[model samples]
Target: MATRPTMPAAAATTSPDDLLRLDRQVCFALAVAARNVIALYRPVLEPLGLTHPQYLVMLALWERSPLTVREIGQLISLEPATLSPLLKRLESAGLVTRDRHPEDDRALAITLTERGRLLREQALQVPPRIVATLGMDVEELQALHASLSRVIAASTPAHQPRR
Candidate 1:
């Protein structure tokens, strides 16, 4: 089987008429890569009882707990409408608690539960597993991440993550 090319062979050389090709579309490439990469996290997260979105929320909390709903949304680039359900599910899972922020009664504060905190230990294995699964060099993945970050920033206005 032929290995996938790391990058396109000189997109600049492509004819103007090929501009409409699906293979040449950045949006198309990003869309498929995003879906496939997220899919790869499924089994890796299953043992921890977290979906990809939930895992992301947990990641944000692990770094710093007791964040407001809006704060978490901003950190994860999710809107309130989309984030609310994930928060609710996390709460129901007994992994986190959601309450009114101490200083701001209107904002919901999310804090990790004891179980959630302990889960972090198991979560530690996740990254290595994913890296092994991809069989990609750590440096290569880091480069890809940086490139993707740039794409995200360029696509988003004022670095406000677009969900």
Candidate 2:
């Protein structure tokens, strides 16, 4: 076998036109797919009086109750400013409660009410139900999830930027 010389690393630039191709842009496809997936959840979530972001907050709370507002924001990737209003809405709807943390006066902890805990039973079906509705079996869904998880893991930065 014969070996060929490697080109200089800096000589690998592609034309702007080529770079702009949709097939080459992973971010574009990911954005479109996320939008479409969220759209599918609209009807499912509407009857429960929850927006997608709210549903995400509920998910975190349901997994483990009594997380501080800042903890919830970190888990859901939302800012405190944005999460405050959502928490208020959930509070208004009688789903969650925001109270002062026992140990820290400045920190507010969020807890699920009885109603919120009950909501978790209903939401539990959401994952498998949504998967079944997509016409994919366990194996296919697992494969897709694994692939997307890899992509997300790679895309997320080690140190998130401060807001």
For lDDT, the strongest prediction is 1
lDDT of 2 by residue, 1-163 (tens): 9999886553357765876788778789888878988888888888788989999999999898899989998898889999999999999999999999998999999999999988888887777767766777889878988999887676678644556
lDDT of each: 0.92, 0.87
**Residue 76 in model 2: shift from native, Å?**
1.3
lDDT, residue 129, model 1: 92
lDDT of 1 by residue, 52-125 (tens): 99999999999999999898899889999999999999999999999988999999999999999999999999
Which window of ten consecutive residues has the lowest lDDT sum in model 2?
7-16
TM-score, prediction 2: 0.82
Candidate 2 backbone collisions, by pair:
none
